[model samples]
Target chain A: MIENRPLLNLISHLTLCLGVLVVAFPIWIAFVASTHAPEALNSGTVPLWPGDRFLLNYAMALGLETGQKTLNVNLISMLGNSLVMALGITIGKLLISMLAAYAIVFFRFRFRMLSFWLIFITLMLPVEVRIMPTFEVVADLGMLNSYSGLILPLIASATATFLFRQFFLTVPHELIEAARMDGAGPIRFFIDILLPLSRTNLAALFVIMFIYGWNQYLWPLLITTDEHYYTVVMSIQRMLSVGDAEVAWHLVMPSTLMAMLPPVLVVILMQRLFIKGLVETEK
Target chain B: MMSNLSLANIGKTYPNGHQAIHSLNLDVEPGELIVLVGPSGCGKSSLLRMIAGLETITDGELHIGEQQVNRLEPAQRDIAMVFQNYALYPHMSVFDNMAYGLRNRRTPKAQIRQQVESTAEMLQLEQLLERKPRQLSGGQRQRVAMGRAIVRQPKVFLFDEPLSNLDAKLRGQMRIEIKRLQRRLNTTTVYVTHDQTEAMTLADRLVVMNAGRAEQIGSPLDVYHRPQTPFVAGFIGSSSMNFITGRLDHHQLQLGELRIPLKQKVDFNGEVIVGLRPEHLHRGTDYPHRIELDVSLLEQLGADTLVHGKVPGLDQELIVRLKGAAPCEPGTRLSLGFHCDELHLFCANSQQRIN
Candidate 1:
């Protein structure tokens, strides 16, 4: 970037293009295969360009067409399920973590640091580590196969709590004293001052938690036996394994491409806020 | 409308058993400005915070108007404070920052707007009302802080070293502006600061505090002219007062290799710590007692030059203030004299002023 030599520029651009190709070529292949007819994909030579049956393949993949009765998995409802679970987990995690951080930081109580450390200790016990016990708890509560089961198990985030706690600690104590002098009660101060001040952090965390919720395959795969509750990520795995039958590359590719959309949209929408939250501490 | 503020036997002891303020008492009339001035850890700020209701008064009562506010929350105490950092809400616009209190109190919308706009006008912050605190300069932020406090019209205004964060010129400007605003409003205000100049200029009554106690409290001039304690004498002046241990016998005060005839006889004096202001020492033996000093360093302040030097036998350096660009060089001996009555004598053990 500093030196504007022709050779250096060409070399850097070539390296960047190669890196892009390394990351994007597989997604490009998936898009091309999703557009082609099933016969063209079964011919063994992968198509480099998109085909003419793009709409038909996508329509069948979305469960709108009556062409294939055997693979009649409705992707639209799965999309809705993913959206709900994502939103639920994002909002729930943000609310619970922000309140926990607020209590840990601003209020004085018994076992304060003990509570914080208890939450902090859960960072080591992720969903995978405590999956069996968590699943048992969810099953006992009769929450399995429900939206609450998918979202609630993943809602309490120790990282977000720790992040918010550190952010709140950086906030000047004078602001709280000033708010108190201004007759703002604790709830009012939290709503008006603390919430707005933490906007970027919230946005950044929303994008992350939403993506995490959207891509959840293991938990949903374990809990949901009903096709009605299956998320897009869970359906992708179900689409690939059909006992002895051949994999439908056309349907699977389009569904895979569709599954990537919501998370991508979220990132694009909150890119500015996410970058700002990570880079700068806005006062 | 303003109300008088009084603190009776106010004290603060932390839960960890460290006492910050000990049995402090003051009564500020409705329009008076009392400045508590001291160094860091002197408990001046703790006393101010106790009055503001930010910190609890461990032992005594605080009254704003007729109500004893020991149990009242800061909001219920009906006082506003301007902090050293200005403590403006960074996210809120200047207008919102000033209007937040009134809004929280649920004043009518139109009345809130009127109050905020008028307060902004008084602080000359009308144009910058839409700007956030980060967008404004330090002086503007300070004015916004002041405007926020003024808009509330609290019974007592508390300023916790409000102008200390500004640069020298801005601090001076804000200092005058604060004085003007306080005079116009005539609100009882308790201000805490470590700067002696601010204390001397801003206070109707100055409280010089040291080691968790109010060493002296009086008019600035009264405290300056007649400091009852050695700590007050040392802390009140621009340049610290110099102290020298000397002997006082009968009507004669004897320093090392120098003797000055006393103007008035004291009843009892064995060993006395003599206090002298730098400006009190004049050059060339014009009045009475003369002392020959060896020059060590010269600090040339424009209007007055302070010559720091040492006498032949005294352990401490003596500074003499000479008027207007005195062509004095460092390492040059100068003869200086002071009047007999200019001497301040304190008991060496108790450090209490004797004469």
Candidate 2:
């Protein structure tokens, strides 16, 4: 029984490594594809070594892809737009959710339970079921082609509120009492004591919201009809043509890789936050 | 203000209709450490929370230092609390946690540092100031909690079983530390604990509560030696006082085949509980109204023996704490003495102390 301990530890380590590789295979393959030329990719030559075309393909992918009419869709401008949209959603959601969660968790007002239920009820409804209605609502509000239409609906999701509410419930009544005794009115207590105590949840929620914002394709696509409003994912989708003029794997693969940069960087940079946040929350 | 502490007919009924505390009246002299001793669900903590402005009073006046604070937020009460869990803001360093209130009050940064350092030094927490709550020992965390209160230099200090979470040895040690610190600070402190030993050792005055009502408020010795009610006498002592139920036939305590003398004249009771403290039992003296008993169990401590036995027709049992070696053996009758001077008389019907 004792001899198996080292074997168990080894198995765990290897399993974790395998998990990382599995999650990362697509990115690695995409980067490998970017290194090859269009003919090499389409001709079905398996690329084993790093190809010389990486920088060349990157330069082309960084530029606007030329259409049959010779017009172009910008790469960097779309990235900036995507960033603005993501920031809007992430920050807006956090504020609304924090306030809502605080009010739900601590306050003693009328219809408190009812209000919480109303929010909880939203979790049962998928945005896919209401996409048409939501689109009409955005269009009617003249928010089409604007960031608000892209951000607002997504920002008001019940996840953060539910998550933060769970976190605040754990805050000892004594800490709340200590805050009040120290003269930290409700607002002050929420900000100074409760919020600081909730870093783990905040970090985890931030990563979740960031990935959701970055990977956005369908909603941003449905809402923004203009090329100028395209996000990174939207730009990559537009690169594929309907008629099959000639499929260039070189451009498409690099473009897909380019689209993943922000989310990848976010996950790596805030991995510590994301892990700690979720860990603290489990308590 | 009116006085250091006062509560006017305070009460609490939770939303679920759990009546945690009933109409409770209490007053405290300045710098008095009033320990509220009660069993679980007695509403002592709830009453303290109401005074600390953590909970709504539901109905009644809560005054601290002459100011009615029923409407005030916890932070506005000028009071500081040391909780059972310590609640030391686990994420914060000892310095920041202790200095948090001063900073909230907009004390100058230099002043905050000085005050926090001074408080830390007083608690012997200077070396541990850099550590978070998770890093400190339970006793150290308790001290930091005290430091957190002291740095505020608040009008009143409220402790809600702050030492209850510690180990038995640590609890005893911190109990002494807290009493010494309270004396040094001399601020009006109200402490709540269920431990009779704690209530006995630390309080300037004791408030014994039961079933959401204050049963008695007096000095520790006063509550122990001269409890006004049977409940107080029973609740305040470790082994608990025993009461023998009997009728006063011709004003004499009439047990079956046993007649006990009475020093106080009280109404004859149809039913009553007699209480005797273990320390009051003395060996080998006989007088009028001597009773015979058979011993069933004898528990020996280093200092005394607790003789447990049943007398005929008593229905229940009797315990006597005898000093040195006791001559009484199991299933054997030995002569022991009872003096009327040491007898406490209570009304058999109401269970109220008559003597």
Candidate 3:
């Protein structure tokens, strides 16, 4: 990269193109296949280009038009449920983590580090490991098949809390003292000073937690049996498990592409703040 | 309005059992500026924080005006502090930063704006009011920090090394600005700095601290002329006051073979540490006693020169500050003369000044 020789540039550009193809080829194949008729896909030769039924396949996938043996479950409502659960989880995680990190970093109390470590150790006990107990608790609270049930169990993230704690630690002690001199009490300091200072961090965490929430599969699948509560990811499983019937490749491909859009948009929208949050050196 | 501030037996001991400040006391009349000057870990900053109510007083009473503020929160103490790093709220605009305390106190909206604008104008930060702290230069940020403190009109203005973060030129400028602001406001101020020049130039009454104790408290000139402890004598001047072990037999102070006849009578005399200010020594036969110095090093500071060398009988290096450059080089012998009254004598063991 330091040398600007034409041959070197050509070679590097060719290698980059190859890398892109390696990563993007599968997505391209899915997009192309989603536009084709189900009949076109069953022929065993994959289509590499656009087909005539682009609108037809997408319409069926969105539950706007019904095809033969189409998915009886509503795709639009499933997408809505996914959005709600994703938003809820992202917001829930950010709020809980920010407060926990604030308490851990700013206040001095007995067993403070012990409580932080207790939260940190939960990183190892993700929802998969504590599935039964989490499910029992959700049921006991009568929250099964609800947005709270989908979000609450998965919202307490140690990584995000640790990140905020590290950021808060880097904030100079003079700032806290200055705020105290300005007559700002604890909650006032947190809101006026700490919150605005953490704008980029909040944006970055929102994107990450949003994607994390949107892609949740096992947790939703385990808890949500009601079709009204079905997330797009869990519904995809139901789509594929139509009792030994040949899976709807055309419908599934379009829905898969749709499922990836919200997270991609989130990343794109918050790309600037995300990078700033991750790499900022200034307070 | 100005209010007198007093500290009675102020002390601080960390929970880890490290005693940072021993029993210390000071009083400041209304509109007076008191400076706490000491080296690091001398508990100067800790003492200031205690006054501002940012740090809890371990065992003492602090009074601002008529109120005992020992257990009060910083907000309730009615004091403002300008930190070493200027500690302006990085996220808030300069105007908002200045107005924050006023707003917090539930001051009327129009009044807060008026106070902030006037403070900004006084600090010459009117144009920079909409800018954030990071957007401004170091001096501007420093002015904004001062502006923040001024807007509050607190009982006492506590500055914790406010100029230590600036470049030399900017620091000098801000030092003057801070003194002027404090004077115009006529508030009782407690300023802390390790810089001897800042302490000497700005303090109305200087407290020279050592090992968490107030070694001396007086006007800058009074402390300079009459240092009660060896630490104050050593700490006040630009270069330290040179100390040479000598014997005091009656009126004759002896450094090996050289005898300096004392003009005043002394009651206690024996092994004594003689302190000499470099500026008080001259390089000619103008005074009562003359000592020949073998020059070792020369520091030419343009305005003045420091001649570091050793006298024939004294084993320790003798530093003499001369106007402009000295004509002597290394290994050359220079004749230096000093007045008898210029000699500062202390007990060798106790390190207390011998009056």
Show how many residue pairs clash in every candidate, following the order shown: 0, 13, 0
Top DockQ hit: 1
Best by lDDT: 1
Interface C-alpha RMSD after superposing true interface residues, each candidate, one decimal: 0.6, 2.2, 0.9
Error of 2 at B252 (Å): 0.9
Model 3 per-residue lDDT tens digits across residues B286-325: 6888888899999999889999998876789988999886
- Two-chain complex of model 2, DockQ on C-alpha atoms against the true structure: 0.49
Please identify model 1 stretches exceeding 4 Å from their true place. Answer: A1-14, A66-70
> Could you arrange the candidates by lDDT from highest to lowest?
1, 3, 2
TM-score attained by model 1: 0.97
* Residue A90 in candidate 1, Cα distance off native in Å: 0.7
Tens-place lDDT per residue, model 3, A11-35, is 9999999999999999999999999
User: Which ten residues in a row are the worst by lDDT in model 2 chain A?
Assistant: A64-73
Place model 1 in a CAPRI quality band.
high
Error of 2 at A176 (Å): 0.8
The runs of at least 3 residues in candidate 3 whose Cα sits more than 4 Å from the true structure, single-residue gaps closed, are A1-12, A66-69
Flag regions of model 2 displaced more than 4 Å. A1-28, A44-49, A64-72, A242-244, A281-283, B1-3, B13-19, B58-60, B267-270, B286-293, B324-335
